[model samples]
Target: DQQVKQNSPSLSVQEGRISILNCDYTNSMFDYFLWYKKYPAEGPTFLISISSIKDKNEDGRFTVFLNKSAKHLSLHIVPSQPGDSAVYFCAASPNNNDMRFGAGTRLTVKP
Candidate 1:
């Protein structure tokens, strides 16, 4: 069973527009959520994270909103840029060591 799921495999958005990515989890024990961005063959880098204790976290153009009741989370990027084109992964950790990740969502920002 996929503990975490990203329904869309890819998304395309125009530069300067907004890009939204969604994720859902079935594991209720997950207490920590994180978003990572990957480029080409490189490893994923941390983008933003939110704990189950909070509802939302934002950093500059990136924002992550978590709804514990619904077991859902989403990432929002404002003024999407060409540089934002990459694979985005949503991860959740109930314990400290093991983090479950979604297959990933590829975002293509067109200029």
Candidate 2:
């Protein structure tokens, strides 16, 4: 069974709008959650992250929220731009070394 899941396969948003991506996890032992953005051929790049101890973590236009009790997490992009269009993957790890990733959510930001 997959430990991390992204129910939405894709999302579309207008430029300069907000984009929200949802993710869920089955493993409660995961103490760290991360969001990664991937381009066509490039490797996934780290976006934002949240620890089990914190409910929210933000970095400029990217923000990550985690609900430990619910085993749920989300990534929010404010003022989305066309350049932000990419595949987003949610990841979880207990020791920050061994990680499990969601399928991926393709985000299209229309200009």
Candidate 3:
């Protein structure tokens, strides 16, 4: 069964604006949340990720927030650039052995 879901299949934003991607999971056992950005024909590249230990994590222009109680997570990209346009995936894992992925949300940044 699909435990992860990205309600919005796509998002559009202008350059210099912030982009927020949201994901929801039904599994409470998930302790790890990861965000990945995928370019056409290339494998998804790791973006921002967070563990249950922290409610939020920040890396450069990327940040991830987790609400354990709500079983929800969100990835935020500040001042999004055209290069940031890609398919983004949200993944949850209890451990490395089993990870679940949301279908993915395609983000388009227009200049």
Candidate 4:
């Protein structure tokens, strides 16, 4: 069974708007959650992250929210741009090297 899941396969948003991506985990032991953005023909790059101890973490236009009790996490991007179009993956780890990743959500920011 997959430990991490992204129910939405894709999302579309207008440029300069907001885009939200969601992820869920089945493992309660996961302590660290991370979001990565991947462009075509390139590797996934780190975006934002949240620790289990905190409910929310933000970095500029990117924000990550975690709900431990619900085993859910989400990433929000404000003022979405066409450059932000990419595949977003949610990854979780039990504070170790073993990380599990969601399938990924393709976000298309239309101009």
Candidate 5:
């Protein structure tokens, strides 16, 4: 059974604006949160992540926030850029190894 779900299948943002991507999980045992960005024919690249113990994690223009109580997570990108355009996947793991990925949300950042 799939444990993770991406609420929105796609999102579009104007350049220099903020983009928010959301996901929800059925398993409460999820301890780690991760977001990945993928191009057409490339493997997914790690974007941002967080632990269930923390509410948020940030790296440059990307941030992943986990709301454990609601079993929800969100990835925020500030000043979204065209290069940031890609398919974004939300993933969660119980022990850092057994991870599950949700159907990705394609983000388009228009200049």
Candidate 6:
């Protein structure tokens, strides 16, 4: 089964603080990991990704770390702003075309 899990359905953080997102996976065959950010009624936008061979990936205000041994991954956003308030989804695929997603983590960056 291709099951990706985001245990926490929501998270809140004040502006300019660090916001961390967590995800877990049960499928060992998943080799490509990705994070997507979405606003209401919109499709997800690709944020950052790392291959199974890599442990960490970062892009500016966002960072993703993967621990293969635990089948866990996390996304971190620094200096969060109100604009950053949105739903974040963790996804994985054995290839680029086929994927599975977590329910999502709704991050509210309060002023």
**Cα deviation of 64, candidate 5, in Å:** 1.0
> How many residue pairs clash (N, CA or C atoms closer than 3 angstroms) in each of the candidate models, in the order given?
0, 0, 0, 0, 0, 0
What TM-score would candidate 6 get against the native?
A: 0.96
Report lDDT (Cα) of residue 34, candidate 1: 98
What does candidate 2's lDDT look like per residue over 15-63, in tens digits? Answer: 9999999999999889999999999989999988898999999999999
Clashing pairs in 3: none
Give me the overall lDDT of model 5. 0.93
TM per prediction: 0.98, 0.98, 0.97, 0.98, 0.97, 0.96
Q: What TM value does model 4 have?
A: 0.98
Candidate 1 least-lDDT 10 residues: 94-103
Tens digit per residue, CA lDDT, model 5, 1-111: 879999789999999999999999999888998999999999999888898889988899888888888999999999899999999999999999989999999999999
* lDDT string, candidate 4, 1-111, tens digits: 989999999999999999999999999999999999999999999998888999999999999999999999999999899999999999999975789999999999999
Cα shift from native, residue 6, model 5 (Å): 0.3
What candidate 1 gets wrong by more than 4 Å, as runs, is none
lDDT accuracy of residue 59 in candidate 1: 98
lDDT of 4: 0.96
lDDT of 1 by residue, 1-111 (tens): 899999999999999999999999999999999999999989999999999999999999999999999999999999899999999999999985699999999999999
Q: What is the C-alpha lDDT of each candidate?
A: 0.97, 0.96, 0.94, 0.96, 0.93, 0.95
Question: Candidates ranked by lDDT, best first?
Answer: 1, 4, 2, 6, 3, 5
Residues 1-111 of candidate 3 have per-residue lDDT tens digits of: 889999999999999999999999999899999999999999999887899999999999999999999999999999899999999999999995588899999999999
